[model samples]
Target: MKLTVHTFASLDGVMQGPGSPEEDPSGGFDRGGWVVPFMEEDFGRVVDSWFARTTELLFGRTTYDLMAGYWPQVTDPDDAVAAVLNGSPKHLVSMTVTAPSWANTVSVIADDVAGRVRELTNRPGGELQVHGSWRLVQALHEAGLVDEYRIIEFPVVVGEGKRIFRDGATASSFDVVETQVLGSGAVYRVLRPTPFTRGAFSVEDGRETVALDV
Candidate 1:
């Protein structure tokens, strides 16, 4: 299984709550629902594309709770996102959530979460996707487990909120697999992690010399 992460963020990288104002208010974050104004057909199409590859869903407690409370109620058979989310197998990572009420919950991983997720990846499947789980995404990133990132960067500068790439994150680089700018000024980016690189530029013989360690 390929571990993939899907998320929505502001230009400033805030990914706290893109859905509603009351979605995630942790840390006094009042700048929720920033992605709403920019939502358009393009955004839906991009997100649907992500869901198309999802064979399983991996989520942190908060995101899982939010999704479970909402998506199951969306009993629209024609809705592709709701269908995929409600039907796919799910893995929740949390010590507090002992009994998940969501349908098709495979396991609740508390200890050795990275190890468990690695085990899941070793299994044969299409894509085990993590959506709106910033904290879990960070842990998986640190463990070098995320295979791809599908991000929709909205054109808004949320002054204060939880960011996707928090401070003191592991230094890394990504290979841009694809990029598309919507008419709403939102940018959809597909990125794959690459080895972190370092480089330096200097002037030699009046010409520029570049040195890089890949």
Candidate 2:
């Protein structure tokens, strides 16, 4: 079982509050729902296609709460995505979360998230997918637990918000596996981890800034 992590991010790398204005307000982020206007039919089709392949879903506490509070009540409960989300197996990774509000969900309380995830991936069945859990995704990436990454790069840039890649986070290189251009100008890129290649750098005798692309 491969673990595919899917997330939408701004040009500046912010991942918080792409769905609604009031989704997350931490860090004085006022520009919520920045990715809404870019959702076109082509984008929707891409999403639906991706969700169709997922057999298991994982999320963080906050994202789990947000999704559980809304998706279950969608008017079309039998809709493809709604049905998948409502009935599919879900794993919420958190230490403080006491209970899950959604049905067909379980809480994973392990501190060694990567190890737990690896165990899950090695199980006998389908692919596991992670959606909109930046912290957990970052941790998985650092641990090399993520097999594939589906990143929808929106056109807008929110200078202040929770970023996918932040300071002090471990860096990993990715090779582009696939790319799709949405009608909304958002580019959907699928990346897979690859072996790192060394790059040359000139060493200066005096003080200098070493530019590292994270």
Candidate 3:
């Protein structure tokens, strides 16, 4: 199973909340629906594409709770996102959530979460997708587990909110494999993580040149 992350972020990398103002108010995040305005048909199509490859789901406690509160209520058969989320096998990473109320919650990893997830990746599946699970995403990133990132970057700069790559996050680079421009000025990007690289601009033989550190 390839671990993939799907998220909506602002231009400033804020991924706190993109659905509704009441979605995530953690740490007094007032700018919750920054990505709402940018959600057009193109955006919906991209989101649908993510679910098309989802065989399982990974979630942090908070994100799982948030999704459970909403997705289960959306019983629309035509809603691709809701259908996949409500029906897929979900793995929750939490100590407090001993028994999840959500249907199809197969397992909960309280201890040895990274190891458990590593084992999950070895299972037969297409994509074990993670959505809106910022904290879990951070841990997976640090564990070098995430295979790809599908992000929709809205053209909004949230002054302050929880960012995807917050300060002191695992320093890694990404190779942008795919990109698309939505009608609402949002950019959808698919990135594969890569090792962090460094380079320096120096004056060599009276010419400015870039010296890449190997």
Candidate 4:
């Protein structure tokens, strides 16, 4: 089982609420639903393909609360998007949430989220996917537990908002796996982590030589 993270962000790196104005306003963010109008069929196809390969989902408390409040009551039961979301197994990480109201949901409030997530990744499954949890994503990244990243970079730029990448976050490199351009000008990029190659340095005759081995 591999843990993958999927998220959308503005060109300026804002990952604040992309659905509704009231979804998140911690930083007085007014441009909440900025990603909807730009959504295209090509993007939808990309999401569908990605979800089809995922076996489970991980979400933060805020995102879980928001999604639980809406996705279950979606009027279009036949909609493919709703079906996938409603059917996936979800693990919500929170210290304050005593009970989860959503169906097919579980609560994981341990102090070591990275350890638990790594344990989950070692289990038998297709893919454990994380969505819309910037904080949690950063933690997992720092723990070096994320296997792949699917990022959709929108063309718009919001000068200030909650960003996907934060200061002092872990430094990890990736290899591009897939890239596509949506009709609405969003760029979809998929990346997989590559093994780190350590370099050796040797000094001889007052000169230094470096060699890298993978």
TM-score of 4: 0.87
Quote model 2's TM-score.
0.89
> 1-214, model 3: which lDDT tens digit per residue?
9999999888888899788899999999887877777778998888889999999999999999999999899988889889999999999999998879899999999999889999999999899999988989889998999999999988989988877776888889899999999999899999999999999898989999998864
TM-score of 3: 0.97
Question: How big is the RMSD of model 2?
Answer: 4.4
Candidate 1 wrong stretches, greater than 4 Å? none
Tens-digit lDDT track of model 1 for 64-86: 99999999999988999999999
Please give the CA lDDT of all the candidate structures. 0.91, 0.84, 0.91, 0.85
What's the CA error at residue 125 for candidate 1, in Å?
Answer: 0.7
Clashes of 1: 0
**TM-score of each model, paired residue for residue:** 0.97, 0.89, 0.97, 0.87
Which TM-score value belongs to model 1? 0.97
The regions of model 4 sitting more than 4 angstroms off are 195-214
Candidate 3 all-Cα RMSD: 1.0
